[model samples]
Target: MAQKYKYARPGVETTPWNSLDVRVTDPFGNRITFTQRLPE
Candidate 1:
């Protein structure tokens, strides 16, 4: 299935392995992808 959402207004913090999961439907239903780099 194509991803319908990406990114969220999380709490006060976020990590690469953590997800806020707040979803809103995209009218266009376009696929989106995001990458979070690990801390160096």
Candidate 2:
């Protein structure tokens, strides 16, 4: 499955940890990824 979203307004700067990518695994061994990209 695939998903996407957007934010109209964003901060000037964001923390390092704010951007994260988490890998999720299902019982069948399928993997999904979640990521967050901070403001520029």
Candidate 3:
């Protein structure tokens, strides 16, 4: 019996991260926010 294996795929659609936002609270009752923006 022969074994089948998958190789690296070609012509994969690539997309960029547009933006992101995150918020967090610390133990000292503090608020934190992180924002990121990417170019098209």
Candidate 4:
């Protein structure tokens, strides 16, 4: 699920992330971040 977000655009959306979060920046200078809640 998280893998898809790596190439996501401004309008795209997907399931939230887990412990292993991911972030990336495109050539257009757009940044996307995927994060999830930590275990209690």
lDDT of 4 by residue, 1-40 (tens): 4455544434434434435455668867778776655564
- Encode model 3's per-residue lDDT on 1-40: one tens digit a residue: 9553233222322335666656565656576666677566
Each prediction's number of clashing residue pairs: 0, 0, 0, 0
Candidate 2 lDDT over 1-40, as tens digits, reads 8443232222344347676566566556666666778665
Weakest ten-residue segment in model 4 by summed lDDT: 9-18
In model 3, the worst 10-residue window by lDDT is 5-14
- What C-alpha lDDT, on a 0 to 100 scale, does residue 29 get in candidate 3? 58
For candidate 3, the lDDT comes to: 0.51
> Model 3 compared with the native: what TM-score?
0.44
Task: Output the better candidate (1/2) by lDDT.
Answer: 2
Candidate 4 regions with alpha-carbon error over 4 angstroms: 1-20
Candidate 2 residues lying further than 4 Å off, grouped into runs, are 1-18
User: Lowest summed-lDDT stretch of 10 residues in model 2?
Assistant: 4-13
Model 1: ten consecutive residues of lowest lDDT: 4-13
TM-score of 1: 0.26
When 2 and 4 are scored with lDDT, the better candidate is: 4
Task: Give the clash count for model 1.
Answer: 0
Score each candidate by Cα lDDT: 0.42, 0.54, 0.51, 0.56
Q: Kindly provide the TM-score of model 4 when superposed on the true structure, using C-alpha atoms.
A: 0.39
Residue 36 shift from truth in candidate 4, angstroms? 1.0
| Cα RMSD, model 3 | 14.4
